[model samples]
Target: MRIKTLLVALAALVVSSFAVAADYYVDITNRTGYTIYYMYVSPGKSKSWEEDVLGNDVLMNGDTQRVTLTGYTNPYFDIRLVDEDEDSYTFWNVDVSTQDIVVTLDHLD
Candidate 1:
């Protein structure tokens, strides 16, 4: 009986850990006619932007894409966009506790 109880506790712990690492989807929208060259998401500031580009995906205007990230927490989702250096934008602080997040990219031109 004791062993069964211990096993149950262990199983619960494992399940909870996996739940904490839940998956989230973000809608990337490019309002600008120009295509966004790159899109990236990371835990914190990264010097090498290429390394942090999630799945090497680029979002075009009026397009929506979904990417998955592991170990995402609440209150802040780090995301950024770059268009030929001259046009770059980063949303440092995002609240992800909600169901869905809509990111709209405006035209720099």
Candidate 2:
């Protein structure tokens, strides 16, 4: 009877462990009429940008990519989008928690 109770307690603990807050994922849309070769997202208060989230994948014009922001609790972020020609578009202090992102030429840094 003790073993059965222990197993039930363990099962409840396992289920509760997965109930943490969901990570924020923002969809970024490319509207700059250029193919983006790299993308970076960093916390708004940070001095430097983090790793390129796009990796080897490119975001073509009019394409949308979902950026996963894991382990970050801040809602504001600085996003950078680099094109094939190395031109960068930067958006600073963007509220990424509530809305999606749309990158355009007006965002050129």
Candidate 2 structure lDDT: 0.90
lDDT by residue (17-104, candidate 2, tens digit) is 7745447788999999999999999989999999999998999999999998877756788899999989999888988888788989
The best candidate by TM-score is: 2
Per-model root-mean-square deviation over C-alphas: 5.1, 5.9
lDDT of each: 0.59, 0.90
Could you tell me the C-alpha RMSD of candidate 1 in Å?
Answer: 5.1
Report lDDT (Cα) of residue 27, candidate 1.
Answer: 63
lDDT of 1 by residue, 1-109 (tens): 9999999999999988873555655665666555677777665444544344534566666776665655655535667766544476666655444533344444232
Q: What is the TM-score of each candidate against the true structure?
A: 0.57, 0.77
Residue 47 of model 2: what lDDT? 99
Q: How many residue pairs clash in each candidate?
A: 0, 0
